[model samples]
Target: MRVPRRRRDAVEVNLTPLIDVVFLLLIFFMVSTTFETRQALELELPESVSGVAQVSSPVTVVVTAEGDYRLGQRALSADELASRLSDAAPQAREAGLVIEADGRAPHAAVVRVLDRAGALNIRRVRIATAEATHTEAERP
Candidate 1:
């Protein structure tokens, strides 16, 4: 008696089409995307356990524990800070403002700086602080 011939079953998990689609997508994104640059002006940014990625084009106002105010690295008085914020409002790229103060700085001082910044229609503000000085702290 002749035995019946068996047919091979079809393979189900086809990755070839998926791989081609993925590769094409990668190539398209690589060709069309522009990379953002890392700025060069350096300062020791305070570390945080829950800090988010720093935003681009922030107007940084720093206050020392002794009550000195700085715009980036340049110091500014209360009136000067207000004037600068008012002047720069028209040209600022971001509506967000970042004010970093030393640990010992008083809340009132921080409030004062923030109030003036608010007058210029700066809506978003954040306070920056270092991670609680834990030993063996690692960079995230």
Candidate 2:
């Protein structure tokens, strides 16, 4: 008598659970991530008819209407401002200094900052200003 041979079944892999696990991992990473935000000072720059575009990123010094001085959003005294400018002189010599003074700020304050920048031998100095609009011209 001849013995009957047993037939073998073809093996198959199920991918539904593998795809579900991958999607869960993606969602877990997306929900656990944190984003960083930068701090900035609120300012209203003076307007001018001949305002020019800035080419390089300069060290920004902000003078408020209340006569307060800020460098990169940190408040500092006149002496501190001078020291900071001197420390940054090498980089500023090429990148320049930008004075972002408020419109309501006193002229003397702006001039004082300019004088400080000059003392540091920073020749490339610019006063930040917005372009004058037709409405602004009509108002005055």
Candidate 3:
């Protein structure tokens, strides 16, 4: 007697479910992700050839063209700035103070900050400036 031969069928994987899952994940990430816009004062920094690297988390004083003062992101009056600097003397002495003054900022404002730093005896004070691209002679 002859034995009956068995027939085999080709196996296939269904990818519709996988494609649907991938699409769902992509949509979920797209919907859950957040986009934030940063609002800041547009400042043009003075150029210098001797600018050094900033300290780690130094006390930053921002002087605007309008002569407004910002101490580490908070706006402060001269009196408040003086008081705050006095209060932060110990830390500022160790880490230093960074003065980020706009190119068009008042000379008096910058001088005032420097004088305050001088009063505090904070020897590590630094003036922040952008790197100068042109030579001194090239500048008018």
Candidate 4:
């Protein structure tokens, strides 16, 4: 009597389900993510009892406590500041300018930024300020 033998096929893995799960995880992470903008300069803005919320984007000029000037994230000298402002005249004029001066920043430093803006004829200028968190009794 002769016995018959059966051949076995090659073993294989189905990766479709694995790939689908990976894609699902990727989409979940993307949907759960949030985006925000951070300031380049760390500043303690002066308190204001009448501070208004800003609605539009504007060209920002930062004046540090040490009287240093920053146009965007780049440190600029007085001469450089003037040049840059002039170079972006049209945009600056259209978008307007916002000065974010530190609470302890020198008055002259802020004035210098203002002078430049005036020279460039930028009409809409606003100083960034934090809302006051004090009562009448708290005021000196």
Candidate 5:
């Protein structure tokens, strides 16, 4: 008598579960990630109803609550600020000037920076402000 042979079927893998798990992991990471802004100086900016977004990178001058001046991370005196503004006049004139004055910062300090920028012939000047909160805006 002759012996009979049986044929086997090819194996197949289902990848739907693996693809679902990968998509879940991607969504989890995207939801858990946080985006934060870092600044060289800590400032509590005043709230404003009509603040506009700046389009260009301009020369930034930070005035702290104690009325200290900081050009980038370096603290500068009144005279030093004038000299530095003079040195950066060309760039300032082109990109404009941005003054970030803390909410508690002295008015005199901000004025001095404005005066220096004016003398340097930097006409385009903007003051940095935060958006008004809902509660604050609702108050009379």
Candidate 6:
């Protein structure tokens, strides 16, 4: 029996399929990604009369240095915040809100954020603060 010879041209990979997959992945990420937009705005908060305690499961609301507020990284206006709270899940609504205020932030700014959350039927609100750096133990 005579042996058959192999073809001179080798198989080649098509780039179009790879490009199509990349485009599809790009679109998928754009559509499915959840964006939280508080990186640009910051709110500073004045010290409170009482110490702020940590909560395990709070609806974290960050007040920036500029007094702008964000909820778990999602920015919100006063009215929108109220509306959003009203529309949140039961657990979300019940989840006490932790308001992170910068040291330089005005008291009024922090109050306003709390007021808005209150208006949305949020019962519990907590402010955020780090351990005092000026405590007697740490001082020389």
lDDT of 3 at 30: 95
lDDT pick, better of 3 and 6? 3
Tell me the tens digit of each residue's lDDT in model 1 across 1-140: 99998998987998999999999999999999877442333334455667665664457788777776777656788878888777666544274677777767777878898888777777777777666455444535
Q: Residue-pair clashes per candidate, as listed?
A: 0, 0, 0, 0, 0, 12
Task: Please write out the lDDT profile of model 5 over residues 1-140, one tens digit for every residue.
Answer: 99887877888898999999999999999999875333457899998878887774457888999998887657888889998888878988999888889999999999999998888789988899989885564788
**Whole-model lDDT per candidate:** 0.71, 0.81, 0.85, 0.85, 0.85, 0.68
Candidate 6 residue-wise lDDT, 1-140, digit = tens: 99999879987999999999999999999999978533655443444445756655546766666666666657787666666656663555677767777877666778887777766676776767665546556569
What is the model-wide C-alpha lDDT for candidate 2? 0.81
TM-score of each: 0.54, 0.68, 0.67, 0.74, 0.68, 0.54
Clash pairs, candidate 3, are none
- Model 2 pairs whose backbones collide: none
lDDT score of residue 13 within candidate 6: 91
**In candidate 5, residue 118 scores what lDDT?**
83
**Model 1 residue 60 lDDT?**
72
Residue 8 C-alpha lDDT in model 3: 88
Q: How many backbone clashes does candidate 2 have?
A: 0
lDDT of 2 by residue, 61-113 (tens): 88988877887657888778888778778877788888889998888888888
Better candidate number, 2 or 4, judged by lDDT: 4
Instruction: Report the CA-based lDDT of candidate 4 relative to the real structure.
Output: 0.85
Best by TM-score: 4
Model 1, position 20, has a per-residue lDDT of 100
**Over the full model, what C-alpha lDDT does candidate 5 score relative to the true structure?**
0.85
